[model samples]
Target: MTDNTNNTPDGIQKFSMNYSERELECTVEKEGNILHLHIDNNINADLEIQQDGSLIQTSGPELPPSNIDFIRKHVLGQDAKGSVVATSGE
Candidate 1:
C-alpha cells in the first residue's frame, strides 16, 4: 500500500521498475475492483479480480507471463493464491 505523502492522488499508486535500458515509472489507477496499469502513455493494461479469486487481464497490450505475474505480485501486492491468468501466448 502507498501513502498519500507520495504526491499521488487518493486511490492512485505509483512504482518504478528497472528495465534493461531504463527505469520506468509505473502508475496504477484503481477503479472499483479493477486495477489499470499505465506502463507509459500508450502501453497499459487492465486487471480484474475474478469471482474465483483469479487476476485476469481483460484488456490492453499483450504482456508476458512473467510480466503479468510481476504486476500481480509487485503492483497488486499479493502472491495470488488463486490462479494468475495469462495472455494467449502464455
Candidate 2:
C-alpha cells in the first residue's frame, strides 16, 4: 500500500530490503508475474520461480522495463497473492 494523498502521478509502490541503500520502488499499473533485477543503469535481468520452487533468471539490457511492468501488474495488484520479489547479486 502507498500514501496516495499527495497525488503523485508516478505512483511508485516502494519495497525495501535489509542492508540495501536503493529500495525497489515498483509501479502498480500492470500484472507482475515475474521479478526483475538491474544494476548501474546498463544491465538488466529477470527472475521467476515456479510453483514447484524452481528459479529462472533472464539477463539483458531490455529486461528491467518488462520486469517493472510485471511488478506493476502482479505484485502491487490486490488480486494477486505471493510473498515478495527482489533483486540480488553483484
Candidate 3:
C-alpha cells in the first residue's frame, strides 16, 4: 500500500492511495458543516458529505467495487485538517 497526504494553500486536503499499483486520490474541502469529497484517478466522483457523515455522490462516473470499498473503509469519517497525514496499509 502507498499513501500520501498534503494540504493546499486554499485549505483543501488531498489524500492518495496506491494499492496493488492502482491509484486513487481524494481532495477534501470543508465549508461550514459540509465537506466536499472529490475523487480522482481510480474513481472520478464528487461526493457531498453531510453533517451526519453520510456521503452523497454528486457527479462523475460510477466507481468500481474496490474503489467504493476503499473510500468507505479509509476515506470516510476521516477528518480533514490543514496538515499532512499519510499512512500505508499492509
Residue 3, candidate 1: alpha-carbon lDDT = 28
Give each model's whole-structure lDDT: 0.63, 0.38, 0.45
The predicted structure with the larger TM-score, 1 or 2, is: 1
Which lDDT tens digits does candidate 3 get at residues 1-90?
Answer: 211121112246677865447665777665443335565634445544443444445555644445544554455434531222122211
Per-residue lDDT over 10-50 for candidate 1, one digit per residue giving the tens place of the 0 to 100 score? 27777876543567777878665677888856577887755
* Colliding residue pairs in candidate 1: none
User: Between 2 and 3, whose lDDT is larger?
Assistant: 3
Better of 2 and 3 by TM-score: 3
How well is each residue in 35-82 modelled by candidate 2, as lDDT tens digits? 454444434455554343223444333333344344433443433333
Best by TM-score: 1
User: For every model shown, what is its TM-score relative to the native structure?
Assistant: 0.66, 0.30, 0.42
Quick one: ranking by TM-score, best first? 1, 3, 2
